[model samples]
Target: MDELEAIKVTFFQECEELLADLEGGLLAMQDGNDDGDTVNAVFRAVHSIKGGAGAFGLEPLVRFAHVFETLLDAVRSNEVPATPDLVVTLLRASDVLADHVSSARGLGDVDEAVSASMAAELKACTDPNAAPAPAAAPVEAAAPVVEASVAVPAAEALIGADDALDDDDLGFDFQPMTITIDEQAADVAAAAGNVWTVSIRPKSDLYRKANETALLLRELARLGPIEATLDASAIPPLELLDAEAAYATWTVRLETDEDENAIREVFEFVDGDCDLEITRGEAVATDDALAALLAGSAPAPAPT
Candidate 1:
């Protein structure tokens, strides 16, 4: 077998491990283990599969995983309450996901009618308003390779989406970074057709989840042209750096007329993993006092 084919083998090997984690986490929830971390682990399992499938151009796996991931996200966010019925549905979805993996491996064909039925059910759990569909789009029986494995690294290799954390010396102090937005320019930028400044500060959990910053930025670029500035000030020297630590932040100037919600969807998957702030116009310092006041976490300023 060629080197590229070998990488595909590695990905499938990783998928088996990930699928095991998915099943374990879902079962934990089903057994009344509604811990936030448990739900996150379950979400990461599906998300990692989706990322790997996308790299391999396995459309069927990616599509089904996306729908499954969405529902898991809702459960994680508490948007969809974890009811007994919901847990059963999640278990069923997990089974279908395993079949997709097996199908991708050229083991056997997946039952299309059942897969489509599960997709609709998963989507409905996330969005009750979604239109019912008889079936999903036609998917290929044998997973095809769109690009050489070397050209696109599998998500499993980049970083684990959900690994148990251990205390290791970071070798440097970690401080959170904030983006400053200029108030006046922001006001003008809030107008139609003006630019939007978005700040993203990812935590260690984001990288732990195997999310790629480049992918998020690429999604943002779809809205309009974007100028991104990386904040590497918090990054320690190589000798002092922690391999597991996420240190860089970004400030992006997007020339788009899209609403804030549109910009938000780009980073939805990493919602709890990062600190995000979106503003219109130029740059200025973020006022901690004002922010606290706005959030209703602190009292208002006294009138002079």
Candidate 2:
């Protein structure tokens, strides 16, 4: 094998070790041994795999690992408490992550539906409003829209489960309405631009995890044109500065057609490691918010 091929093989071998660490750390958390060290270990395992996968251009593995690692990051930062149900979800996510790694290594194909479901579950743990990422199961057009309360118990009692029926089998006609209002608005937004003001202030933990603000800015640029300003006044003097500590904040005015969720997704992996505020229409003074964060004071009110 060539040198590059050998390096790829070595990365997958290391992935095995990382996956083991991920599983072990999660199991420990499930058993109520969830201390700082255990959470950090779990975060590191997913983070390391994500970094290596990006280098080799394994997009599927990288995407799944990114979602998985985001939840772990939230748990590590204590933004999302590590509860029993969440721990169970994390365990299932780890299994899907392993399947991604195996598929990347050409060992087998992962069920796309299952992987999407796991990614959605992980994301939901972080943002409860996030809908499931998997495509909805197709429903037969001819089936009657029976009352959910009555149909569920009736189906359970009669056939033990509900199955799709043909129009002849159902002996009823069903009409469906097509709603286009949301779809039309989305299309209009795609044609017209929306402006968003985003402010980011990174804490020391953001740098500690090897995340870079520059890369985030670059990713934001992919959505649209952005004007970014850096505030370095918070930095202490050179002699007092710590290399691992982050002191810079950024204000970005972005003009894009993307929705708020797209903008938020850019910072998902850094969830609690930084202070981020996204505003549309009138922008808030994020500098005041940053100051409040540093001083442990209430944030300044938004202008009317």
Candidate 3:
């Protein structure tokens, strides 16, 4: 196959894996394991699919995935509860999403009515008070109404007479800001001279997306002196290896007074795409102890 065709094939293959993860995570939540990581996994799956679809100009697939993702984001941010009804709706939406992927691959056509119906259901989960669009309502017609209703209030708030408005007038309470600084805390941190251990294990998708490990390491090095070790224990024999799969992980010992957040900022863009942890402590006396600490802690499974 040509390069474009090959890339398209790879994207669909990744979609299959992501869909499996999405389904598995949803099932776990259904079984009462609704943790933050599980919610993040589901969000990442849809997000990756949407990103790939957009690259290929799969407009319909992207559009539906975008709506599906918005609802998932609400659940992630705790704006909406992961109630039984919402989970059921999300699973049904996932099925439709799979159909959308198939249609994008030219396997078959998705009925407009079915897609529209599912989209409306997903939208309802985002706004509990909002009703699903009538089945007879045209998709284009219903979409504009929803968009306008949401946009108008925001526009009015910005342009409305500010003198006439109070904190309560906006339908939500507003609190004044406060800021304080503790010089003693800063002095203690500086005096402690603590070091941090940063562990990172990136999934294959990170490389596939052209994220450079070298760049991440360089960024970390900027924060302080870093001794990095690459672990290739997971690599298979050459003949058994898949070129696209990631098998290596990294363990880095950083001698920096930077806070944990500073270390995490190096990996913020890839927050959900990899496994990362930062812990602060006194510097280790030997490399072996650091290695043992790194090896003893099992890395979270990389994104599927």
Candidate 4:
């Protein structure tokens, strides 16, 4: 391969690792783990990528990376400082970045809108006192809402899920939603920094290979307190059930000190083998709300 091609390949490989670390590092910071080395590692990754992109003259990549790298440097030098808002913004920028790279690889500029939005957001995030860097405008939309209503995408600095559906190449057939939590699960969740409700459907190959849905729920229990409710409401009984298919649907209330990521980590071994949706839950304070205290604290009064 030519030098440019080699660099591109390495860039892509290293970038994937970098992005993963960036995300994990950001998450760590959110949970009050401010490790300077983690922040430095993320900053270096962006800086290196920007420098390399500049040498290669990939304008789009270099342009965005310049702004992104600036924000990283700001955080690294403690010029801007990391706040929860900054962490969230940075994470969203990471998504916009995924869109940018996809466009670079010929994904048809699907994310120009997002890129512009993030660029504006980043500009506001850096310190005015720091040596300033060049800026890029957000990508413009051709058919913007009206002839006169173009809201400028502002620039600023740094910041910064799951649903499983029967997804085809074109659209999706959403499965039913389920929620559950047992007393033991509540205790576990109360102990943890957070808990989440997660639902998953096994992949097509999973059923054919004898993967048991029940077993997945049981395994999830070990990570913390877990109560599993079977959503067999969709199941057909007796002779009508598909013998080879997975019949048990589950809704789990998991309690743990784990962050959103750690909650997702429980399903690590089964990834791509199943579809999952996990949302961070509202912080449940006090155990009386979860225990079977029907007098006044029974989760909206047991649905009447």
Instruction: TM-score winner between 3 and 4, please give it.
Output: 3
Over 1-304, each residue of candidate 2 has an lDDT whose tens digit, in order, gives 9999999999999999999999999999999999999999999999999888767756667668888888898899999999999999999989999999999999997888888788888888888998777574453343222221221111122221345555565544433222212334333432454877799999987666556676567667767666677889999998999988888998876767789998997786676789999987424335467456646578977889
Model 3 worst lDDT run, 10 consecutive residues: 145-154
Pairs of colliding residues, candidate 2:
none
lDDT against true structure, model 1: 0.76
Prediction-by-prediction clash tally:
6, 0, 0, 30
Full-model lDDT for every candidate: 0.76, 0.77, 0.72, 0.59
Error of 2 at 216 (Å): 2.2
Candidate 1 Cα errors over 4 Å, as ranges: 1-6, 9-84, 95-192, 282-304
Candidate 1: residue pairs that collide: 161-209, 180-284, 181-284, 182-283, 182-284, 186-280
lDDT ranking, high to low:
2, 1, 3, 4
Could you give the candidate ranking by TM-score, starting with the highest?
2, 1, 3, 4
Which regions of candidate 4 fall more than 4 Å away from where they truly are? 1-3, 108-110, 127-304
* TM-scores, all models, native as reference: 0.50, 0.53, 0.45, 0.40
Model 2 residue 83 CA deviation (Å) reads 8.7
Q: Per-residue lDDT tens digits of candidate 3, residues 1-304? A: 9999999999999999999999999998888788899999999999999888767757678767877887898899999999887888888889899999999988987777788788887877766675564554343421111111122111222333354665667664443322233435433533676667677898986666445566567667767656677889999999999999988887776656678877886774454668887777533333344334445653454469
Candidate 3 global lDDT: 0.72
Model 4 residue 159 distance off true place after TM-score fit, in angstroms:
57
TM-score of model number 1: 0.50
Candidate 3 ranges with C-alpha deviation above 4 Å: 129-131, 134-304
